[model samples]
Target: QDVFPSKGGSGTGASATRTDPVHELTPELRRARERLLPVIESLPGPIDWAVAYGSGVIHQANAAPSSPLQSPPMTDFLLSTPSPTQFHTSNIRSNPSHYPLYARLLGGSAVAWLQDRWGAGIWYVSMVRVHDLEVKYGVISTERLKRDLEEWETLYVAGRLHKPVLPLLTPPPLLPSLHANLLSALSLSLLLLPPRFTEHTLYITIAGLSYSGDPRMSVPGAENPDKVKNIVAGPGNLRGFRRLYGGLLDRIPGVRWEDGKVAEKGWIGFNGGDGGEGEDGEGWIVQPSSPAYLADLIPSLAPRLREGIAAHYRAAPPNDFGSGRGTEAGAGAGAGAGGTRRPYGSPVYHDIAFWERVVKDPQFRTVVRQELRKIMYRPALTQSVKGLFTAGLTKSVRYSLAKIGKWWKARQARSAV
Candidate 1:
């Protein structure tokens, strides 16, 4: 459970920077932070951050209305460690059942190698029964986690974090990065969403970032189709959604809220005016203007977040109309006071029109969809491989049958259509 190397120093371990503002503890949040944190903290590893997500956490979120004895699906944790290989090497010895026989025997170095080389920067262990909770967890280096969350390099962890999660352990210094990641996810999702949409639809679009092109989606029940709607529909969850996006929404130009929800006329539009060239004079050539209210909300973001958005446009180039096409590389650029060409990229902070251009580009949307599909397929393939190693013959048989049945039904439905 004590994952950080030290409790006192600033050398990548939990330090003074990790402190959160004191809050009047609510029973729910107290149980999550106080009770659950101890359980995760007790797990053997050097953890920089750990969060419990998926249906198990959702059940916990909804537990106020349900019986405590009710069984939920396996609790899931996504852990960030300073060094995954070292963490897995030690973790396997303490919690051998958490990993497959091969992974345990091969040692932590192999675990780390496989995660980085073959899998997304994380390795997974499933079917772990710990502290009376059935759990599955994925481990990755803290550096890689932050990178993906910011740049969305794989959209694996990025997609997962887009949804609501209960953070059992987050050191104080890492808090800002986590919040920034969520903001980046929202911005990226907005870039893919239609110009006009409802809050529920907006959350749905955000949630869909993970599942957009997943191959498992071919089988209707492989992933819940109604997941996005459900995540934002329930009052408890809706509140969580609002907590995540509310302030950000309030600052977006042309986004209006009435009575704590998005109003009908809350259509997002860009104000075309000359602003500063992107942070570096080489990223995006021109910057989009923002209202005073919206500008105040911008936060410093990861360089890759801005760079990734720029990459999409830089590939196709944009016209003067901001259509994100044509060979006019200087289309969005504004001349410097010195009248020199300043090739700008997306700002490392908020750029509403930059994101809006991304959203409006058909080619960009296609690329996003393709990348999303890749991310989705990897999990399906990884889970199946892991299942063969970890699951009993009977459980595997039943799972295969269920998948077949679901797939057949889906095929039949399509045939009828």
Candidate 2:
């Protein structure tokens, strides 16, 4: 049996040998993929990953058109490449009109620089029409995307992956960290949520994570107030959520499904095989109260998040401190040469007492929320500002005004009631 069924693209020396895996899409999702294939394959040579996600691709009921005059939502894509400069060069050469006049004037090197050196390490090319379909896409280097996933360096790409997406191509190299990103989201959601929550609640929390502390989300005309609820409200989207995360939930220990197991077998996940045994119903998942059990949760978090939690404990100096190799007296503690703090790097799971205090504190959830805000807020706002430039003023205004219209309508409806 072939380990990787297809080696896509005539990659340059670096991308020549790829072990791209196959995805089993649902009928609706498969059609989405089929519609997007031409656009995907037509892109500049090799890409690390290609995925379609957003309200457009998932089609939530609340986001549907209210009148015949409404245009279909543009399908959004996130593409990862080994080399952004090379990819941009090829893309701009082929699709010069896709970018704004200013971006086109800047050239590929400048565009890639703005992307890599700027907020959240992504570059956008929006509102392109291809193959009779309206499309918008963003590009980030594979390494940067992997860091965002594994390190939570920025939740930009990582957050988008939390919800359902139609992945056109996800090669072996990016799968592990991508799965780690999902696992981290679950661990955080379970940590923050009540001891018992329905599957809908879990999905809702995960979907809203990227939006938490997002400055744009606070602005009335910037986003859909019900975006998170709408994301997971419909049956189609709920099924998409199951396909994305059910496998991981099934493998977690000590979680009891109250109604029905959401994960069905044979969904492609981190293991690249079936999701193992699972049932077919939306259910309430119960998490245990054990601090020891909770400590395991902390370890799987992205390093940045894990460090934040650990720093909080160290600062407060729990009674159980110094049990697992105390910092020397007058030592820099966990600080580096420049007086910046880094992770203490000790295995945290062994510090059961530390976790006991962490989990038991009434403020634990609050601390996690604040830490998430620190990780998420700035990048989201900065990226939104960046989008204004990348998407061009006309498109940006059109997008913002559309959202404002939606916001106004929703507010007026509430007022009338």
Best by lDDT: 2
Identify the leading candidate in terms of TM-score: 2
lDDT, candidate 2, 292-319, per-residue tens: 7777688778878776666665565445
Residues 228-298, model 1: lDDT tens digits: 55555543454455455655554555554323321222322111011111111111111233333223322
Task: Name every residue pair that clashes in candidate 2.
Answer: none
Q: Which run of 10 residues does model 2 get worst, by summed lDDT?
A: 1-10
Candidate 1: list runs displaced more than 4 Å: 1-26, 60-70, 258-417
